[model samples]
Target chain A: MAEITLDQIIQPENMVYTRSRIMTDTVLHYCPGCGHGTVHRLLAEVIEELDLQSETIGITPVGCSVLMYNYMDIDMQEAAHGRAPALATAIKRLMSEKFVFTYQGDGDLAAIGTAETIHACNRGENITILFINNGIYGMTGGQMAPTTLPDMKASTCPYGRDVQMMGNPLKITDIVATLPGSYYVTRQSVHTPGNVRKAKKAIRKAVEYQKRNQGTCFVEIVSNCNSGWKMTPVDANQWLEENMLPFYPLGDLKVPEE
Target chain B: MGELRLMKGNEAVAEAAIRAGADGYFGYPITPQSEVMEYLMAEKPHERTGMVVLQAESELAAINMVYGGAACGKKVMTSSSSPGISLMQEGISYIAGAELPCLLVNVVRGGPGLGTIQPAQSDYFQSVKGGGHGDYRLITLAPASVQEMSDFVRLGFELAFKYRNPAMILSDGAIGQMMEKVELFDPVPRSKEILPWATTGKTPDRERNIITSLDLDPKRQEDFNLKLQKKYREIEEKEVRFEKIQCDDAEYLFVAYGTSSRVVQKAVQLARSRGIRVGLFRPITLWPFPSKEIFAMTEQVKGILSVEMSAGQMVEDIRLAVKGKIKVDYYGRMGGIIPTPDEVVEMLEKKIIGG
Candidate 1:
């Protein structure tokens, strides 16, 4: 077979190509059929549509998406484990004109960083938070997370999450919505094309609120960890609807009164 | 350029910070130093000079807020007492390790536990030596009076930004609570000085900036530490400062800092009245310790008295400087009890003039 030239191999039309300066060109290390790919794509498309690449600053937390900055083409700051909110607080306050956002996982946000996230939201800082709740610690070999549903089995919870021993799944959106500074709080799932579209809207609204300097806006994307859950992408989405959605029902928790 | 105003040391610090062109103040209220936060709140520097004043929930969050502001290349400050300052040591170490410039003030009260709300100089080692878990040192300045307490804001900020290091103004309950007359000076605006290293953002004309302290490699951290040590050496040589009173022909030298210095000054006067040749060496920069100055006095004075608010803290430094060249005596009062001038004079008579 003849070796294909670089130009011939490139097809911009068939690929997802847009103006998001936040995502880098580095090859993603995420497993095939992982929901992170879908979520990252949706966010990148929204960022491209909004034309916020230059003014956007992404914060990467410690988790499966720890290297999320590597795929984004924009300026990125890596936070200490579970400290994205604190770092974002600094970045946004210092550069108020810049659009700042944090991409965190359930373990990083709901568990180790509970206080940081709560206080940051309570303080009413102006920034967007994109929380990925996968119900388990993916990068750290699938330990249970604060968002792990009851009866969900993981490396740490082989007998399934016992509410008696472990705590109940944290309802972050509901808790954060109670804070007066929260201009927008919504939870979305990315198991279906329709749900992915809805997740995109929630993310877009969050970014928009940040743009308007309204206040803290958070979007929780209930994603699937295919490898950690020990299922194919299709099966994971189906499992999500049957198991996770009932517990973590997705919808807007708060919005402008108007 | 004005008349002296009588004010509490905490209020003077707040006023001086505002005049020092500080754009941000993030602090929590703790006794003996609550006035610093209250003054900033009531005065509302944000309304006049565009300063950002925030009352953080805890000293932990407040210091982190200062860290964030400093990371932005803005002049920020935080004030706390001994217990609160203890909680800030981790963030301070991070700031120093990252080489971010900011100001911190410690209005000390008694402490080992939640010791007391009264005056104490027990944090001498904590301030001069590294309090946090690291091999780093912060530039520590000890103010002996309310006037110097206010004046320290200017010097602390100047040294902080100049060296890209954290500068600390270590005072105590007395200095923070007592009233004194001070002639304040306006701070030179930061815009007047050019700081190319500040992390504003990536400009079209320059390279992208990253403010971080993550060094995964051992060799690289060693190099960074070496550079820090060299910078510290330069600061030791150039910034070490102290006050010397009547030491030209003295038989005894009283070495002290902060509130202890005032006690020594009073004792020196009393000694002179009794026809005794006693002098005082007061260190303004606690970390630098005025070693050369104190070392020079070894030839003039028969013995050095280390008078402090704690149980022989600064005496270690006095002994180190004297290096057995002269006899060293210690006088102290612990647990928030300040040694009176008479107590120091008596120690001098028993330890030096009589011995």
Candidate 2:
């Protein structure tokens, strides 16, 4: 067989895919098969597709992806725990021409930073909020979060979450969708190739809303935490589909009226 | 001076921020400092200069907003009273640690816990001694009059940007609420140049800028801390500001600042009338405090009395400054009580002269 030359294989017609140009060469710190790496790539792809790589300012929450800037070649600010929305609020307000978005986890958005989250959405700030709900506090060793499923066992709820004591898991995205300030609210996942494509489309749409000054765009990605879930990556996806989706079903919660 | 008007100290701060070309002002309403936001809203600088003025839901949100604004290389500020300032300590610490430049004004009321709405200087220790959870220093300015309140807004931004650290105006309820004549400086047009260190979206020309305080690596964190300390040391050497009144012929000294300094001036007058040779020394910068200058006064004075609205917070710094070479005594009223000129003189005569 003839040798496949590097130049020949790299031809545009032969190139099936390439990593997003906005993503840096830095190594990701996520565990193998973790959904964070996938979602990050999706966001990078969206930024590149819209040619906003130089005009986007990202706000990262104080969770596992606190170092999101390390992987993204974009101007970024690391916000305090649950304070990403507050930071995004100011950044978007101060620089209305730039695209600003916050990446927050379930604990940050639904638990510690409830007030910041709710108010930013209610104010209808022109920004995007990307929420990743893994049900448990992944960075803090699996502590149960406000979005932890009922009866789910976590580090803090080792005996399983008792409905009487821990109360019901919060449906924060639904609550956010109800806020008039939010121009678009959607929920998607990246556990599979099909899901990844949908999630990317959702992110691009959210960024479009921000560009139009249409108010806050909240996109919640129900993701997996194999390490925090104490399951293998394959089993975690299976478990998420069978268990997590039943409580936090995925789809657009709110859409712009035609 | 471009404009002359009668204004409350808090109002002066707001007006100065706009005139100084501040990029944003985020704050929540609190007594003794509510006028800061009220005045900003009324002026609508957003319409005039494109500056953002947001009334945040809480002090916590306001300060964090300041962090974000500062991270973007914008001139940002927030004002609050004692309890509100306490709620903002966490955000302030993060800003300090992140090396972001911003301004803060604490129009202080009395408080261990929501003590009173009246003036007090009890936050002296909290302001100077790293109130939040880290070993960082805030460049603190003590504004004495409505003019200084207006003036420090610009000066604070200069110092904050010069060091890439947070600067605070340590004020009190009396100064914040009292109305007096203020000469405002002409507006400084906001600059369009993008700072190299700011987190204002990356261009194809530069490496992306990041605004963060977290350093998981121990060695790098220590180096940053050392760098911060070095900056503070330089500030202490270069920015010590103090005003000495009649100290050339003084035998006794009355040391004070902020609202207390205003009263101590009259007390100095009263003491001199009684043929007591006493002068006043007012510290303008509280963190890069007038320590060396106060120590210099020990050679020309016999005894020193420190007057404040707090029980004795600033006096300890005075003791550290004088280094026990002279007798440094403290006298003040607390729980939002203002000291009278006569009572201050009596304490001076008793605490230092007699003791």
> Best-fitting candidate, measured by lDDT?
2
lDDT of 1 by residue, B154-247 (tens): 8999899888899999999999999999998865554434245544544446444545566657999999999989988989988998889888
| Per-residue alpha-carbon lDDT of candidate 1 for residues A88-134, written as tens digits (9 for 90 to 100) | 77667756888888889998888887877888888898989989998
Question: Each model's DockQ?
Answer: 0.31, 0.85
| CA error at residue A30 for candidate 2, angstroms | 1.1
Model 1 misplacement above 4 A: A1-21, A25-54, A57-87, A90-95, A136-144, A151-161, A189-197, A224-242, B187-197, B351-355
Give the DockQ of candidate 1: 0.31
* All candidates: TM-score of chain A: 0.91, 0.96
Looking at model 2, residue A191 earns an lDDT score of 87
Q: Any runs in candidate 2 off by more than 4 Å, and if so which?
A: A1-13
Q: Write the per-residue lDDT of candidate 2 for residues B1-355, one digit (tens) a residue.
A: 4789999999999999999899999999999899999999999998889899999989999999999999999999999999999999999999999999999999999989978999999999999998898999999999999999999999999999998989999999999999999999999888687899998889989989998999999999999999989999999999878788888899999999999999999999999999999999999999898988999999999999999999799999999999999999999999999999999999998999999
Q: Pick out the ten consecutive residues of candidate 2 chain B with the lowest summed lDDT.
A: B239-248
